[model samples]
Target: MALRVTFVLPVFPRAPVGGFRVVYEHANRLTALGCQVTVVHERWREGWSRPLRHLREAARDHRHRRAPHRAIDWLPVDPRVRLLIVPALTPAHLPSGDVVVATHWKTATLLPYLTPAHGSPVHLVQGYETWNVPDPAPVHQALRLPFPKITVSTHLTRVLSDLGVHSGQITTVPNGLDRTTYRPPPTGAPRAGVAFLLSDSAAKDSRTALAALHQVRAHHPALLARAFGVAPRPRDLPPWIHYAQGLTGEDLAAQVYRPSAVFLCSSTTEGWGFPAAEAMACGTAVVSTRNGGVEDFCHHNQNALLVEVGNPTAMANAIRRLLDDEPLRTRLSTAGLATTATMDWQQSTAALLTALKAIS
Candidate 1:
């Protein structure tokens, strides 16, 4: 008999975010492996007056009017996978399945109410998401729910351990790279520029990255800079830096990583930093802060140049070092490519399936 698995998601963004992408990939791969996979999306609701709530929903809908309706539009989702859209997340809104997975802390908080109809839930801890919630006590309490936990990086595992989850209850499944899409360019001579991701979120620290880029430009005026993000282009961005909005994965690989001399990541924390790994897979050297997740694959002075968080001067120095020393850049790029070569979706998905089977 095929295993019936359902994943509960808080909201589906039009643009591809790292955490959502992981959930989509697992659903698609599990469907291909003959599991009955279903994705349930719950729209976020505000605890305001009905009139105000409707207005907020209308604004959100208008903002994403150009976005696609289904995951298949942007990602490679199997047709066999079923999608369920619900207005709100409640016990009555969910479907009973052999296994239920909560993709975020908000959903995890509701698992206790769900266990009677469904089964012991599986909490997929992608990051330390307490920072995003208004009342983190609920998120912390959810972490202690009697359920199996699967995390994406060593950093997340450590976080769960700190939250009092035993080592036996948590499983570590690292994120994988799509080798087909993110591989080295045909010829390895990249243009004289650097690339980084832009975001409005505080943790992404886009301002620090911009500051570091400004410092790099002071010394190397000829150098170019580019940024890609799902957010609207900020008016404060220097005219010299090229900005691209809502780029697809293929476009990002071709336009940003493949052509850039180096990729920069200034995130303060991550469950697993996908941009750095993807850039390295495209054979670009990376200069990133010690964002927890990147530590899994990024070895300082080997596969990447690591610096402390919020230090723009150190980030600028690392970027300058790579730009000036071609030999060092080549070594890091070569090593980075090798590091990601072994990380494939197939392997990671198989590991996930094994963990699921053990618990189920």
Candidate 2:
């Protein structure tokens, strides 16, 4: 009989973020590997969204939050895959399988109960979401579920151990990207300006990126910066950098990645560093700090321009290097694409499958 796998992320079936995207990739890819897979999640936040501002829209229409048409049910899933979408109030209902993978901290806590085996549930940790955030209801509350103990990074694995989880119980398995779908933007596209992405997600430390932007524009007065995700308020930073809120898929590719000179990451911490990987794959030289998994995918001189964490001056200098040295940027961009080939979704997916099998 084919091995059965259940990948549970209680928060999913929602919008596309790093974790959501990773879960979907695994769902499809695991099926290709001949494992029967079931994905259980709640696609929308619904009535539970504590943020009043966000609630009105999710309540007005399920489609009001993000790409409303981009619901999980409508996607073409693999024949061997089953997807379950539940509302917020409903408890995750399931039993043990050959393998149970939990993507979030809360989901991991629930995994032991979701399935029969409490001792060996896989925790797909991403970063210091625990260290940086205030209310770690999902992660800490889930850690109570007996972390299946697998992580997405060494830092995360260590974090779990520090939190009283057994070191041997947590395995590090980083997230991988599909370099094939992510292609370099054509050189022919008219360059509108330099592009930067921002999300308030605490781990993103977008404020650090903003701080660097202040120094960048000051030194190079002609430099123009454009952005995405929720625009920072007046208190966030200076007015020189442009912000466009959020973008995704092809629109993100054309509008944000195409004409951008270099991709920037000023994160204070990370688990897998999703934006850094995507930027490199799109052939944009990345100027980022050596935060988290950037070390795994980026080679300081070879693939990216990495700065010391928390140093805006170094960050600005790195960006200035990309702006001034075309050859260097091209070299980093070209090398970055080559680096991504080795660390594609295939690599991380293979490790995840192996970990599942090991526990099984």
Pairs that clash in candidate 2: 13-43, 14-43, 121-148, 126-271, 149-170, 229-245
Candidate 2: residue 51 Cα off by (Å): 9.1
Q: What pairs collide in candidate 1?
A: none
Kindly provide the TM-score of model 1 when superposed on the true structure, using C-alpha atoms: 0.93
Clash count, candidate 2: 6
Residue 333 Cα positional deviation in candidate 2, in Å, after optimal superposition: 2.1
C-alpha RMSD of each candidate structure in angstroms: 2.6, 4.2
TM-score between model 2 and native: 0.80
**Residue 204 displacement in candidate 2 (angstroms):** 1.8
> After best superposition, candidate 1 residue 43: deviation in angstroms?
2.0
Q: Estimate the lDDT of model 1.
A: 0.86
- Put down candidate 2 lDDT per residue, 178-243, tens digits, no spaces: 565566866654443466767676666677777787788787787778687644444554466666
lDDT of 2 at 88: 46
